[model samples]
Target chain A: MNGDDLFSGELENVMRWLSTAGIVFALISAGLIAFFLTRRPGWRMTPPAKWLLLVGFFLLPSTTMLLGNVVGFHRVKTSCAECHVMDPWISDLRDPKSTTLAAKHYQNRWINENPCYTCHTGYGLAGNLEAKWSGLRHVWHYYVAGVPEEIKMKRPLPVKTCLHCHAQAASYLKIEQHVDPEMEPQILSGELSCFECHASPHPRKNR
Target chain B: MSDPSPPEAKPAPAEPRRSILALTIACVLALVGLAVTVLHLAWPSPLMFTLFMVVGQGSFAAAMAVYLAVILVDLRRRKVL
Candidate 1:
């Protein structure tokens, strides 16, 4: 099913309109800023509407973010057949790298069985809007605070996010066999998350 | 040639009071913006939350640059270079 077919006419229209609006808003905002920079004289607006326009300026981006979240949530929840046909982007997860990364959900079994959301929920959930406290806070910790280089060479394991799912299958992993004898203390104490030995599910290029 | 002053031995630069004032105002705005943003991130404040809900996409850094650019142009016109 094409995306057009997957979504009802109204929903598809709204999605299209939203995506287009986001692009246009981004472009227009960038362009206006550029124009204001090059031209010394500022564009004058009527005093009464100026505040309203400023308010609107801020609202547009936030609205786009919300709309994007809604559409993205919908896209992921749809069936596999709908995914392959409607959104090829979702299907691209079948690629080897994505497959391998996703496989770490289980120790050895590499199967494309679970829908992406089954294990990974609560992302972008319009709540927990703190800097070090949001839903994405865990990711920031993993990338910036949690993983230490010294521990990585000494022992390989997954990060905290990995353990969120792997905790259930802890018995499957022969922990002692996988972890170095030296680092057993940390591993056994739950101090070291799994991503220590296993590579990060999502690795950044530049640290 | 009056010991042709070494290029590196130039007189110390003077601070522009006008520029300083503009910068002070800019810094205040930026701090307020950052505080609101941080609050919005942590525990959302209604006013700040509303502010962020709008204009969240426009880069604050870019806005700062624009604000500074305007001030710089004004300073130049005032022969403060």
Candidate 2:
């Protein structure tokens, strides 16, 4: 399907998930209230009950967000270590491997701290920025708003951000050996990000 | 020991206070969502359209309805005929 079709389908799925989650949240909130009421003898719900229920409401979303943060942190750490460099960030990345080639994204400067979402847009279990913003609007999302309403805002790295430090010393023995056309029209026109084609940047057999 | 007024001691029922506040917030959000939706329908700017549609104005309506339902349930439980 076309991009528009794909985006629409994805949005429908997202709304369905939100509906399910909202129902679950409401159910759990009610269950906790029931449990709390049962626990207290002759509990006519003193002022403390209000505070307790409010705290639980606050904690519900906060705990979910904290868990999400942990998972995101873990993913970035692991992904960065797959083919990271021998440097400060890479050294501290989740898992380090000296054996892998230098072409990995872990070695890339942009992905160093940013991780997968840095390029891969959209929210899911991982969270994604909606297509409501893209193109000039995306630039505005970063530059104008300064703060994205839907998702966390990340400052755009320097021009040629991904390639600036990535196209550096190749860990491979033969540096010239590569795949895909070294140059593309899209790149010259600044129409595409490096991740569009060279997502992982791993060299294949043919260019 | 001091005698306490029924209003002070009873505290106007927690259910009504909580439900009213939740319902009011839900209503206000629903109205804002609706306003955004109307504006998008008229002007159709990308930004405004995004604000209204993808954010799901309908979702806000649904939330308000749920809050109203909760208030009804609480009212019934409290036996306010």
Candidate 3:
């Protein structure tokens, strides 16, 4: 009963619906374009023909393409696991005995859904897009330079990623280390990492 | 009298080549979007995810631009601009 399971199941249904619509519209649109492409545009430039083109080319495909990303990208962890390099991290997440921050959060259900994306996306309204674009960069790197043998984090873990959830928590505020005025600004300003005090975010066994 | 007033082939349409080019490009872009969308849905990997999000949405936008251009040109020809 992982939260991701429930959310992912819902997204799966939506994705199926969207993909079906995308395929249908794409077929119709392409077929209609071909229809007009081969024949005389002047001869068939009727209002109905125009309507067909509008629906086929503009309306349907636009909706389908937009929704496709939503239903498709919403399930980031599932998508992340597709690459072989991610297998160990994903395995650690699922391992009951693993003590890494990611594993603890997963096992404890601290993150209700999209645990992978939520933790890694840093913080912003565009955080999702940032993460996705970063993923694209990863894809480019994987195909080009390949994952470094160590598969290290590309950037420092954003403090805001932790603050996004924990900053306002009563338990988080009550922590003795957090109350230290000298360290508070450093944490907020990204000078110090929470992991230094807490623990490393992930296991260091990447290969 | 050797073939007085000989026949001649009809002239082609005066419309520009880019009109057709735009239509063709739109179709191709749509097909690519469709293929990429399906691939993402099928696999849902980061590569496909990026493609669907970027290439897929981008294809639709570019296709719309070209298709809209074609429509605008037609409208202007009819003096509706």
Interface RMSD, candidate 3? Answer: 2.4
* DockQ for each numbered candidate: 0.03, 0.05, 0.36
Tens-digit per-residue lDDT, A75-159, candidate 3: 6655677778889888888988888899899899999877887787856668877877788788888777678877777788889
Q: Please compute and give the TM-score of the first chain of candidate 3 against the native first chain.
A: 0.84
Residue B5 of model 3, lDDT score:
83
> What's model 2's lDDT at A150?
36
Report how far off residue B48 is in candidate 2 (Å).
34
Give the per-residue lDDT of model 1 (tens digit) for A23-93. 45544544433333233222222243233324333343344445544443343333323312223334334
| Tens-place lDDT digits, model 3, residues B1-81 | 688886975534565455666677877887787778777766666767777877887887788888888889878867699
Model 1, TM vs. native: 0.32
Q: lDDT per prediction? A: 0.42, 0.42, 0.75
lDDT tens digits, residue span B19-79, model 2: 6456445444543444444444334343444454444345454644755575476667667
- Residues A1-207 of candidate 2 have per-residue lDDT tens digits of 566664475644444344344334434544554554454433423456545445333344233223322332333322323321223334433234432232344554435554543543443433233422342254345446663333423543222444334445364223333223554434434455554543333322222
DockQ of candidate 1 compared with the true complex: 0.03
Q: Any residue pairs clashing in model 3, and if so which?
A: none
Instruction: Say which candidate scores most in TM-score.
Output: 3
Candidates' chain A TM-scores: 0.33, 0.30, 0.84
Which predicted model would earn the best lDDT?
3
